[model samples]
Target: MTPYLNLVGRDGIVVLIGAIDMVPRFHSGNLLMRRRSLSASMIGGIVETQELLDFCAHHGILPECELIAMADINEGFGRMERNDAKYRFVIDMATLERK
Candidate 1:
């Protein structure tokens, strides 16, 4: 199996797979950038922002932002690896944000 890495941004931690290409989009007069091209293994389980941050810090991976967004097109269906319970949660980065 290929090792997975977390995508970190100013908005938050992005739980996705593959190379993430961030693009600026205009939505209803609001300018926003969405992280795209995320695969299943990239975020097949629950992830905490602190865990991601600590991982990055230990690995020397610098984050460009503090905002995070998760994209699971399958809603986490059929993405289990050997029926592991670790893949049954939706991690919300907002909860881990520093006030």
Candidate 2:
């Protein structure tokens, strides 16, 4: 985040990940006061979730991802272990073969 701070200009938006519960302290006391704000939010409950998905579908929005075969699971894991950003890696388990 230090690199990001250096690049942030006036009124830049900084979004944090939901699982990152702790706040990062900046060495400069006025950093937070420099017209910048941070946001991290948890997903809403079932109805809101359904609504969000519905909205996305209505707008033809979908996640950018690459599908890998179940047989290549180990290869995928190996790539992830190497910090490859080639895939989003999320999958729909319902669509998987039992084998």
Candidate 3:
């Protein structure tokens, strides 16, 4: 986040999203001197979420994720342990049907 602050222009804001538990530490002077700000936002409720989904669909925006079969969860864990998994692992529930 410290390095990211440098990338934003003056008065630009950095918005942190999702469930981040740890408090971020950075030099406050970077924000103060540049009139920049940091903010956190929730995804919002069902209706707003649907609107966001619609906007993303209209813009052809998509998330990057790796679909893994339920049977291969152990391998997935191994990949995580070895830091080999580059994308978020989304368990494909339909994969369980074969078993």
Q: Give each model's whole-structure lDDT.
A: 0.40, 0.69, 0.89
- Which lDDT tens digits does candidate 2 get at residues 1-99? 566665555565667756666777765533565676567677688999999999999999998886776667778788876766464686456567875
Q: Write the per-residue lDDT of candidate 1 for residues 1-99, one digit (tens) a residue.
A: 112212322233324454456523323212124332322343423456678877999999974432223444244444443333343355455555465
> Which candidate comes out best when scored by lDDT?
3
TM-score of 2: 0.52
Comparing candidate 1 with candidate 3, which one achieves the higher TM-score?
3
| Clashing residue pairs, backbone N/CA/C < 3 A, model 3 | none
Candidate 3, which ten residues in sequence have the lowest lDDT sum? 80-89
lDDT of 1 at 88: 36
**Candidate 1 all-Cα RMSD:** 16.4
Task: Give candidate 3 misplaced runs (Cα > 4 Å).
Answer: 1-39, 97-99
C-alpha lDDT of residue 97 in model 1: 41
Q: After superposing candidate 2 on the true structure, give the runs of residues whose Cα lies further than 4 Å from its correct spot.
A: 1-39, 91-99
Instruction: Give the candidate number with the greatest TM-score.
Output: 3
